[model samples]
Target: MVTIQGIAFIPQNISKGGEKLYILNKQDVPIVDGLINLNSDSSQANLSEAQQQLDLLWNKLDLIEMNDELKAISPAMAQGKIDKRLIIVHRYIRLNYGEPLTLQLLADLINCNPVYLSNTYTKLFKITPMKYLQVTRMKKASELLKETNMSIKDITTHLGYVNNSQFSTIFKRYFSCTPVEYRRNQHLQMRSIGIF
Candidate 1:
């Protein structure tokens, strides 16, 4: 299968100028190779159809780029390109905090060396990526504890902890209270506010 996804962004300047315009296109098509004999008439027909679709997509992209609304945004996008590697790492951590994560795994995700990723991430965020993962996991665990009826053991397991004791130790070190205490305190605070 082949999928083409497009997103359009209006620069800050354009927004300040009081114009809102965007064009987004998303489509998916199944592509099968070796489905018919190479010289067969059916194969030739399918190839022609695919080529027409691709040409249409390119025409649309060209039109969008030539549009005045997109012209105002293109230069800004070109001038202020964000670091894709950093975004990828941050998103991976946020989405996968419940899974076991390691420095090497994060580096692999961004196709960079572990040492380089660690150094770059530390410089950009003032904390190592692994530490960020740990903090993220702790934050999520804290939220789950306060909001759900899940037990300590379940929360620990959900956050990728090997055991409840280890989870409690780390949770205490990070939040200055064990998970149980934190949950109890949250409940008491909620009650005081007439929420519980």
Candidate 2:
């Protein structure tokens, strides 16, 4: 007789994947037990229950099928499909510029291979994720420089830079001036234009 072993309840963790559930037996670990993802609209309390529900659901989904109208829009549908995932990853990186956002973390969040994600992201956006992150940090640094009187060390720490020297080098490379010079120039330019 089949016995219920163990259970694993993985919530709707987007960083792990889409909405998915994994169940294992006493001997089977969560990672090894395999998973049954609730793709459409159905519930899987258990494996046999999941199989039964999915089989019925598949038939229903197949009956509706894709028509000529849907076929014509397949590319659009596919583009939209990937675009949402891409936007989510991009926005997360933009919003978490001060965090240690490693490539592995981003890959897990977006549910793709790190190398593939890196290559595809670079191809689609014309920049690597690290490069994008660096630019994002620089943007934040620029905003702080223009708006606040924070010290160089403070800006460096706020931007998650390892040290002031690294921050200053990148800041200079991007703005053609050191942080101090950049901040000074920004203030003088704003005052000259009555922007302050």
The best candidate by TM-score is: 1
Worst lDDT run of 10 residues, candidate 2, spans 1-10
Residue 145 CA displacement from its true place in model 2, Å: 0.4
**Clashing residue pairs found in predicted model 2:** none
TM-score of each: 0.57, 0.56
Q: What are the per-residue Cα lDDT tens digits for candidate 1 across 44-132?
A: 57656654654555555435434543344445457764345865796688788888888889889888899988887776555688887
| Model 1 pairs in collision | none
lDDT of each: 0.67, 0.66
| Model 1 stretches with alpha carbons more than 4 Å out | 1-83
Number of clashes found in candidate 2: 0
